[model samples]
Target: MKGAERIEIDRRYCKGCMLCQYVCKYEVFEVGQERSALDYLMPRAAKLENCRVCRLCESHCPDMALVVVAKKKGKGKE
Candidate 1:
Protein backbone atom coordinates (compact mmCIF):
# COMPACT_ATOMS: atom_id res chain seq x y z
CA MET A 1 0.00 0.00 0.00
CA LYS A 2 1.13 3.52 -0.70
CA GLY A 3 2.30 5.54 2.31
CA ALA A 4 2.24 9.20 3.24
CA GLU A 5 4.39 11.65 1.35
CA ARG A 6 4.10 14.29 4.02
CA ILE A 7 1.80 16.04 6.47
CA GLU A 8 1.13 19.76 6.36
CA ILE A 9 -0.16 21.65 9.36
CA ASP A 10 -1.15 25.25 8.81
CA ARG A 11 -0.01 27.29 11.76
CA ARG A 12 -2.30 30.14 10.84
CA TYR A 13 -5.34 28.08 11.69
CA CYS A 14 -3.88 25.68 14.27
CA LYS A 15 -4.65 26.16 17.96
CA GLY A 16 -2.08 23.70 19.37
CA CYS A 17 -4.54 21.50 21.18
CA MET A 18 -2.27 18.53 20.35
CA LEU A 19 -5.23 16.44 19.28
CA CYS A 20 -3.23 15.47 16.23
CA GLN A 21 -0.44 14.12 18.40
CA TYR A 22 -2.87 12.20 20.55
CA VAL A 23 -4.74 10.72 17.58
CA CYS A 24 -1.66 9.61 15.69
CA LYS A 25 -0.99 5.92 16.28
CA TYR A 26 2.53 6.13 14.86
CA GLU A 27 3.71 8.93 17.14
CA VAL A 28 4.24 11.15 14.16
CA PHE A 29 3.63 14.42 16.02
CA GLU A 30 5.32 16.18 18.90
CA VAL A 31 5.03 19.46 20.76
CA GLY A 32 7.32 21.94 19.11
CA GLN A 33 8.78 25.26 20.24
CA GLU A 34 7.35 27.02 17.24
CA ARG A 35 4.33 29.18 17.87
CA SER A 36 1.39 29.62 15.55
CA ALA A 37 -0.15 32.85 14.32
CA LEU A 38 -2.49 32.72 17.29
CA ASP A 39 0.52 32.53 19.63
CA TYR A 40 -0.03 28.91 20.57
CA LEU A 41 2.67 26.25 20.42
CA MET A 42 2.48 24.05 17.34
CA PRO A 43 2.80 20.33 16.99
CA ARG A 44 5.58 19.10 14.76
CA ALA A 45 5.35 16.19 12.42
CA ALA A 46 8.57 14.49 13.46
CA LYS A 47 8.38 10.78 12.65
CA LEU A 48 7.09 11.15 9.12
CA GLU A 49 8.30 7.71 8.10
CA ASN A 50 6.00 6.10 10.64
CA CYS A 51 2.87 7.70 9.19
CA ARG A 52 0.42 5.45 7.35
CA VAL A 53 -1.72 8.19 5.73
CA CYS A 54 -4.65 7.14 7.86
CA ARG A 55 -5.79 10.79 8.06
CA LEU A 56 -6.52 10.44 11.75
CA CYS A 57 -4.58 13.58 12.54
CA GLU A 58 -6.37 15.47 9.81
CA SER A 59 -9.78 14.39 10.96
CA HIS A 60 -8.96 14.91 14.60
CA CYS A 61 -7.62 18.43 14.24
CA PRO A 62 -10.08 20.84 15.79
CA ASP A 63 -9.02 23.74 13.63
CA MET A 64 -8.75 21.70 10.46
CA ALA A 65 -5.10 22.63 10.10
CA LEU A 66 -3.70 19.17 9.50
CA VAL A 67 -3.42 17.63 6.06
CA VAL A 68 -1.95 14.24 5.25
CA VAL A 69 -0.60 13.84 1.77
CA ALA A 70 -0.45 10.28 0.56
CA LYS A 71 2.17 8.95 -1.83
CA LYS A 72 0.94 8.65 -5.37
CA LYS A 73 0.89 5.14 -6.75
CA GLY A 74 2.86 4.39 -9.86
CA LYS A 75 0.93 3.30 -12.91
CA GLY A 76 1.47 -0.37 -13.76
CA LYS A 77 4.28 -0.62 -11.22
CA GLU A 78 2.68 -3.50 -9.37
Candidate 2:
Protein backbone atom coordinates (compact mmCIF):
# COMPACT_ATOMS: atom_id res chain seq x y z
CA MET A 1 0.00 0.00 0.00
CA LYS A 2 1.38 3.39 -0.94
CA GLY A 3 1.31 5.89 1.88
CA ALA A 4 3.21 8.70 3.52
CA GLU A 5 5.52 7.98 6.45
CA ARG A 6 5.22 11.51 7.69
CA ILE A 7 5.14 15.14 6.61
CA GLU A 8 7.90 17.38 7.82
CA ILE A 9 7.34 21.10 7.96
CA ASP A 10 10.34 23.26 8.67
CA ARG A 11 8.86 25.71 11.13
CA ARG A 12 11.81 28.03 10.79
CA TYR A 13 11.09 28.54 7.09
CA CYS A 14 7.31 28.26 7.25
CA LYS A 15 5.39 31.47 6.57
CA GLY A 16 1.95 30.00 7.47
CA CYS A 17 0.31 31.14 4.25
CA MET A 18 -1.83 27.97 4.54
CA LEU A 19 -1.11 27.12 0.93
CA CYS A 20 -0.32 23.62 2.08
CA GLN A 21 -3.68 23.23 3.71
CA TYR A 22 -5.41 24.88 0.81
CA VAL A 23 -3.84 22.60 -1.77
CA CYS A 24 -4.11 19.35 0.18
CA LYS A 25 -6.84 17.05 -1.11
CA TYR A 26 -6.86 14.71 1.90
CA GLU A 27 -7.23 17.40 4.54
CA VAL A 28 -3.97 16.40 6.14
CA PHE A 29 -3.14 19.91 7.30
CA GLU A 30 -4.97 22.19 9.69
CA VAL A 31 -4.49 25.66 11.06
CA GLY A 32 -2.53 25.55 14.31
CA GLN A 33 -2.14 28.01 17.15
CA GLU A 34 1.55 27.17 17.49
CA ARG A 35 3.89 29.82 16.13
CA SER A 36 6.88 29.11 13.97
CA ALA A 37 10.40 30.33 14.43
CA LEU A 38 9.52 33.23 12.16
CA ASP A 39 6.57 34.04 14.48
CA TYR A 40 4.00 32.93 11.92
CA LEU A 41 1.26 30.49 12.88
CA MET A 42 2.08 27.07 11.45
CA PRO A 43 -0.16 24.50 9.89
CA ARG A 44 -0.31 21.20 11.75
CA ALA A 45 -0.40 17.79 10.14
CA ALA A 46 -3.58 16.77 11.83
CA LYS A 47 -4.61 13.83 9.69
CA LEU A 48 -1.46 12.18 8.47
CA GLU A 49 -3.18 8.94 7.52
CA ASN A 50 -5.35 10.88 5.11
CA CYS A 51 -2.28 11.92 3.12
CA ARG A 52 -1.91 10.18 -0.21
CA VAL A 53 1.65 11.32 -0.83
CA CYS A 54 0.51 13.32 -3.86
CA ARG A 55 2.93 16.10 -2.86
CA LEU A 56 0.52 18.90 -3.73
CA CYS A 57 1.21 20.58 -0.41
CA GLU A 58 4.97 20.30 -0.85
CA SER A 59 4.83 21.81 -4.31
CA HIS A 60 2.40 24.54 -3.35
CA CYS A 61 4.38 25.73 -0.35
CA PRO A 62 5.80 29.12 -1.43
CA ASP A 63 8.31 28.96 1.41
CA MET A 64 9.36 25.39 0.53
CA ALA A 65 8.79 24.31 4.12
CA LEU A 66 6.67 21.25 3.51
CA VAL A 67 8.20 17.86 2.84
CA VAL A 68 6.19 14.68 2.40
CA VAL A 69 8.10 11.56 3.35
CA ALA A 70 6.70 8.55 1.56
CA LYS A 71 6.49 5.20 3.28
CA LYS A 72 9.01 2.75 1.91
CA LYS A 73 7.58 -0.34 0.28
CA GLY A 74 8.90 -3.62 1.53
CA LYS A 75 9.97 -6.45 -0.72
CA GLY A 76 8.07 -9.70 -0.50
CA LYS A 77 10.01 -12.57 0.98
CA GLU A 78 10.02 -15.65 -1.22
- Model 1 clash tally? 0
Tens digits of per-residue lDDT for model 1 on 1-78? 657898888989999999999988899889999999999999988888898888989998888998999888889853
Q: Rate the local accuracy (lDDT) of all candidates.
A: 0.89, 0.90
Output the worst ten-in-a-row residue range by lDDT, candidate 1: 69-78
Each model's total of backbone clashes: 0, 0
Superposition TM-score, candidate 2 onto the true structure: 0.89
The candidate 2 region of ten consecutive residues with least summed lDDT is 69-78
Name model 2 segments beyond 4 Å from true: 76-78
Can you write out model 2's per-residue Cα lDDT over 1-78, one digit (the tens) per residue? 568898898988999899999989889889998899999999999999898899999999998998999988778822
As for candidate 2, its clashing pairs are none
* C-alpha lDDT of residue 41 in model 2: 94
